[model samples]
Target: MRFLAFLLFIAFVLFAIFARWFFICDILNLCEEAPVEVEVAPRLQTLQLTENDSVLLSGYDQFAFSKGIDQPELNTNNEQFLDTLAQMLTADTTKSLEITGRFTPQEKDIMAGFYENMGLARAAAIRDLMASRGIDENRISLKHAITSDSLLQEPLLFAFALNDLPSEYATASYRFTNMTYSDANFPSNSAIFDPGEAFRNYADSVKVYMEAHPEKSIRIVGHTDNIDSEKYNLKLGMRRAESAKEYLENLGITSAIETESKGETEHVASNDTPEGRQENRRVNFIIE
Candidate 1:
């Protein structure tokens, strides 16, 4: 009887230990940090303008915005950086909008705070900057802003891109919304090829068109099919744009030619079929 009792006691002790260990592990996991989302405030869309076909801006250079950081203020390189930003906003005329420059993923380390708070700082700074410019709080926009390295390709929030700028305006305004300079694919751009004969004609036509009208700026947009990754599409987009730019440059209409790419992000055709993919891989030229 005593031996059976001893055996029962041992079994009970083992079960208790196992139960304690399991619960402890579960508790640890529960204590882990949850995934965080960076939320930006509603942006200002009213003040934006599109001059001609592609370029976007605020009606003037006086306005600016700050980019986002993953971890709130934790990565602040130095307290002086914040002070410098504040000073730039305050002493407007002396500094040419200290564009906190884009976040170029340099090896420079940033102190971590909270990720959400970091984004908040960026938003707050932009608002403060605009308010200082004598612009009403309602007129400023931070919705189009981003902390990524490339402004041209950030598929952020419901923000409108430079494409939303009005094409009818002779000279539109765009503010320095944010910077994403470190993104290897910067603008995640892409392009479609107008190879062979059509390519030559497109090139030649642009040359003639620009030669006839010297006062306008030409915007070359390259698009890519959804057949590949966003990064690959972006490269293809650049190639398409460069092909167009080189074509126009060769024609000697050198004054205002800008190139951009919209890899898979901006697709005109369905990605499911071969024909649609082929159609998606082309470039567009917007002239103003």
Candidate 2:
């Protein structure tokens, strides 16, 4: 009986020692396992806009409309502007016009639905004028004003710009010729490609494209969100482009590959939203 009691005491002492050691290690975080890396879901790809086609037509002093009326009458001075705009739109059949209206916040509240209706009405009026001038009505797109940073003292401030090629064309071109990938393909704040399936698939696609187009050279352009200083982002962007270029080279692509960094200069979407930021942080390939 005495030997049995001693054994039971020894067992209890060993259990107490282990429990105390485990408690100490847990308190010190020494028993914690390394965090498992979670894979990020692939973002939906969209057709990229052509860089050179974007033009801003604004800052007109003569463009104004009546308070109750949405139809904008171009003054003699503004007629020349309108003529130039119409010429540009008619110059390219693949190009389309995007019209955006601006209104003061106070005016928006005072006029209520008038603010929204006026914007669309003015856009429609512009479309009709352009159509009358021989431009295709189907090529014009109107987007209502969502928000304005400052109040426009003028009757209304409007901007007209050209859209890129149609979505069908752009999408087709992207699938066949260009490969676009986002920052999610890389580790956080790293130029190294993450060991993810999305990145590997992108690499495979690029390898196939290069094999199919031996005569064409590729330009890798990297861009980043407006999260850091321009200089820092520029360097980061270049590193990312270099990383991609290196990956391609390893894939046995012997064609010439050039890398460029635009930093935070050209943003595809507003940086205020998470999705927009994600869209901004991307690398594009231009096959020449």
Candidate 3:
């Protein structure tokens, strides 16, 4: 028995040495291999901007100049355009504006940074003007692109599109007719969904609509009353939205659903009254 034990110990040591020398070191490709050459596609060769039906600022000759928009140089046309944009934005709280700066292909090499900077500056200038005219700054987005089309004489183009929905969805005639649940439907300071029959019916209706229209997307926006700090309210609002999203997902609604928290910033009612505060803590479903 002792001789057998000694032989077993020797076999174990030999196996360990073999493992370290051959299996660990040689069998496993621990050594660095030669680097491989990969083919990469060239960028800036194609123009990504597409022509859309929604045109807010079209053929504005003022933006054609290389210099940024000067406040003094804004002519009657510019002022009228700004006024109309501000009015449109004021009328629709869900609408947002996008400004794109398009540069000619010839100028791409000479003024790459200039085109980008000018695009942002132009959008910022327009946003500032709109803000001065009583439109919120958060309702605007800015982008820059280089277009090979020489026909685009204007350096900047403005388009007004829905904030949450794609342009195609926005133009569709279908409307979401279901009424949203009020704050009373949910438990106090909780995001858990203990749905009554009415709430379940509403969710079913939304699910049916979404299943029929797979292309459409919905945004569940949650709002809270001004009871706590803005940070706490924001988190609570997000939780509420998430709760709604989970409920909808469980209902087999296959369409894309997103959640947003407005906190106490976008209140539907005055926070002074108890009734008003209750009304403020609600969720809104925006179909896109």
**Top candidate (TM-score):** 2
Cα lDDT of model 1 by residue, 1-288, tens digit: 999999999999999998887787676554456789898544323332232354333322122233334322221322333344445435543222211222323312331121112332343355454465553433333322224444312222211223234332111112221111111122334232323432344445556766777886777666676776889878877787786677567667675978888777765446788745554555566666
Better of 1 and 3 by TM-score: 3
| Candidates ranked, most accurate by lDDT first | 3, 2, 1
Rank list by TM-score: 2, 3, 1
TM-score against truth, every candidate: 0.32, 0.42, 0.39
Off by over 4 Å in 2: 1-161, 164-173, 195-199
Worst 10 residues of 3 by lDDT: 167-176
Using alpha carbons, what is the TM-score of model 1? 0.32
Per-residue lDDT of model 2, residues 207-272, tens digit only? 787788888898988888899899999998999999888988887888899999988887766788
Q: After superposition, how far is residue 154 of candidate 2 from its true place, in Å?
A: 38
Once fitted onto the true fold, the runs of candidate 3 whose alpha carbons sit more than 4 angstroms away are 1-179
For model 2 the local lDDT of residue 39 reads: 73
> What's the C-alpha lDDT at position 237 in model 1?
78
Full-model lDDT, candidate 1: 0.45
